[model samples]
Target: MNKSELEKEINEASERIKTRQSEIETEIDRLGEQISKFTNWAWIFVWIGAFVSAFALIYFICTNTEKGFGLNLLGDFMAGTVASVWSLAGLFFIYVAFLGQKQQLLNQQLEIMYSQLEVKYTRLELSGQKAEMAEQNKTLRRQRFENTFFQLLSNHQEIVNGIDLKRVRDGSWTTSAEGRDCFSTFYERAFPKGFRLRKHPIEPTVEKYAEFYKVNQSDLGHYFRHMYHILKFIKKSKELTKEEKYNYSNLLRALLSSYELLFIFYNGLSEAGKPKLKQLLEEFSMLKNMDFELLINIEHKKEYKEIAFASSEERKKLLRTKK
Candidate 1:
């Protein structure tokens, strides 16, 4: 049974035991009164019998009609009467003693029962305390994971805010863009109009993206690395369930503009992100919300696995199918 139900049962049992104990005590008290009354009556009977025997002996001595009535006869009569009276009193005392012993035995049995009940109650109370501690520990673990998770999220935002890109025209810098706007410039530089007009092999596309990325590595490298670490942190946490991880990753995904997703989509195809980031993207469905029309070549959307863009239910169905 659950803790509350068990505790309630114990409380009810305790009440019953207390009531029984009170009843036993009252019965012992009543027996004591009965024993006291029996002793008093036994003493009164002994005194009355002694008085009658003495009066008969005195009367016999005073009204002796025969000279043969002697002291020996009177002595025998007195001895027999006194012995009988004392024997009756002794039997009454013995019966009272038997009742007293019976009451003591009942009290002893009750005490033993009470001790056993106390032991069971103590054990149950300790079990309840252990259960409470386990729940508290679980709560504390979740709080710690959330604290670090949100901190990483905040750091990711700072990196995004720090990004800046400048456009140069006629050998002089003309315009500048910052934050989420910078990814559009990065995407345009990496995939120009002529590059998208003709169908290109995957290797050449990767190589071309790599060359453009090399030129802008100074601004892009740290941003991608930090982003990778954030996803990695969520993946490595043992405290989070699959659903919890998905929710947190979706929060990170929400921060990215469409251009940011485009950049990430291409980045995943390169050698830099292939080893780990690509798999993480699929695992979290990071591209589920990507704007497919924004890609330089719409067909590029098919390059990654379906899991990268599948909804949570779709991912589950895919997993079951695989199994």
Candidate 2:
């Protein structure tokens, strides 16, 4: 009970109190960490429960239940202040489901678009093939026409080369002196006069020419037949293009040579042969259809003009004499 003994006892009690206070603080910190971990785990349970309740609500509606039993159960489990949080979680799940359905609809539309593209491409390919086939057929027909034209050229070699009437004077009518003199006059007159043959002659002028010459009729029949065949071939081929007409005209021009006026005046065989040949020549003479004025220009050239007539006056006089 002295003063020193009382001070020693109070100091020891103060040390013990300080140690107990530190231990209590450390235990409080550990408890706080455990409570935080439990709170995080409780959030997982809340999300799982919310999703299950939403799915149950959907199932009940689908099954046509009389009462909203699943919704009632959810309300009982998550009541008071926390019910609004659970409702928001259910709405979030519904929004996610809507997004999934929208994506499915977009995928279906894309597939339809792809199918349409494939069908369109196939149709285009078929159309191209048909066009190619049509072009090939056209080419074949054109080739056939060209081949037939070439064969026609080969068949009529003599009349196409031109007949020298002067050389054909050994016939029966030219045996007598009077016949020979008449034939000589006819031969000289026939050149420029025969060049004026009609494009649309109604009758064969072979009989008239032969009578004028006092010669055999057969002497001029070959020439008329040759010209007739050429015209017949042209008229029959109604599908001839302007180019083909021009080409055949050039061939006829070659046969006629300096006798450019022959086509304008020559009479051929048969009534059927007359007007058709006339119309064909008229078509050739057209400015739009052909460059036939060039043929006239060719005839007017020095060499052709000199061979047909020595002078324009002589030509006019000879034409007048014939008329």
Candidate 3:
């Protein structure tokens, strides 16, 4: 059964056990009351028996003691009768004492049962407290994770804002672009318009990316490294599920401008990003929102896995069509 149904069953069983315990206690009380009444009646019987026996002995002595009855004989008869009566009364007292001891033992057993029940209830309460504490700890962990995640996101945006590019002209530098505009300027410079296709496009592409990266390493290096760490942070988190990691990565992806995505696409193929950053890019599907039309060569898309550019649903559809 599911958790709720199982819990319901356990609760019902506990209630049944409690009800049975109560019934047993009630029965013990009733038995105790009967025993008390019987003991009281036994005491009355003992007293009545002693009184009747005394009266009979006195009547016999008065009626049967005639002329020539010896004093010694009469004294012997009275002693024997008194001894028998005392013996009978002593037996009745022993039985009454036994009943009293039995009642005491029963009371002790009831007390022990009550104590055991109290301990079980205390254990159950402690278990509930532990579960509540565990839930609170989980909530705190989630809050801490989200705080760090959003802070890193904000830092990434700040880094993007600080980016700028200057073009060299006649021994002087002029600011050619700033912020997001710098990415487009870098892309145009790296991949000139109407460039002839190389025999091996991959090598030439990497060379172009390396050269462009060297020229603007200071600005681009920090941006790429920060972006890579952001994604890497999400990937390394043990707290997040696969879907949660994907959603967080998508949130970071949403902040990137089209030119920024274009720059990232080529960056991942270059030497600087191939080892670690490229894998993280594909894992998080970082290029899922890239505009294919922006690429200098559309065939460059084939270098990465299909998952890098397509969403899960789109990938599934592609798979079905291939099949």
Candidate 4:
């Protein structure tokens, strides 16, 4: 059953058990009081009968001795007959007392059974509560992961926009390095001397512009760091859905599909920075074979291929294969 249904069922069961236990306890107390009263009355009656029998026997012996141990009205069998009748009366009382004790014992046993059943019901109720708590914890964890993923996606927009593929394709941000060692001091030769901007919009296709061309650009470090953390989070997260992973991967692929943008970013990185960029690509597993031209052509078509569901581990495997 679903969580709410299961919880409701468990609560109902617990309430029923609690009510039954309370009723059983009430019955046990009632039976206990009744048994106590019966025991007291039975003992009082038995003692009274014993005392009267003793007095009668003593009087009979004293009065009948002078009459030759026999009564005038009764024969020699008179004493024997009286004794036999008294023994039968005592046996009847004993039988009645025994039956009362048996009834008390049976009630006590019934109370014990009820007590055991109550304990079992309590345990069952506790188990249900624990199960519900566990499910809630799982749901909370999944929700947190989803929130973090969306936040990262929102933050990465500025970084993605920095690499303007259209600008690179249209021959913007070009400068002259007319008579200098273009290969050795490309950065200095391409831009105006001693000119520095806080942010330069570096095109992704820097290879198309053979010389170092600097325009207003922002620091790409934050963007890369954010992307790295996102990948790591996906790798470690147990709660993310396969479809969620696929969507994240698809977003990365969309950024990479821009031919000039991908080339410029990869080509412009320093020797040390190249490996870090490669590592980032591997994390996203976006190096997989994706025909950008074909995708663009089919962008508005109904027959366009859909992104496939993939987990973080499965996405990592894509990095092992060359594009």
Q: Which candidate is the best by lDDT?
A: 1
Please give, for residues 1-323, the per-residue lDDT of candidate 4 as tens digits.
55466556555655665576556546645654565565566566566656665666676678776855555434334445544555655665566566556655754654454454444434444656666565554554564566457656654654554332222435664433222122223333333243323222233223223333323123334444666666666766787565566556566555543432333233324342345544444444454443333222223222111212124555545434424
Question: lDDT of each structure?
Answer: 0.79, 0.44, 0.73, 0.47
Query: Residue 133 of candidate 4: its Cα lDDT?
Result: 62
TM-score of each candidate structure, all chains considered together: 0.57, 0.33, 0.55, 0.33
**Tens digit per residue, CA lDDT, model 2, 191-236:** 3344434321222343343343344335445554555566567656
By summed lDDT, the worst window of 10 consecutive residues in model 4 runs over: 300-309
Evaluated against the true structure, the overall lDDT of model 3 is 0.73
Clashing pairs in 4: 199-216, 199-217, 200-216, 200-217, 201-216, 201-217, 204-261, 204-264, 205-260, 206-264
Model 3, 1-323: lDDT tens digits are: 44455445545655765676566557656765666666666666667657756775676668664644565655675567755655666666677677667756765664455444444434443555547544544554565467568868977987887787777998989987888888888777887775524323667877877898898899999999999988989998887887789889988999998889988988999887888888988877889889877777788899898878879688556657867
Tell me which residue pairs clash in candidate 2.
197-265, 197-266, 198-265, 198-266, 199-264
Best by TM-score: 1
How far off is residue 217 in model 2, in Å? 4.5
Give the TM-score comparing model 1 with the true structure, all chains together: 0.57
- CA lDDT for candidate 2: 0.44
Residue-level lDDT for 298 in candidate 1: 68
In Å, residue 88's CA in model 1 sits off its true spot by: 99
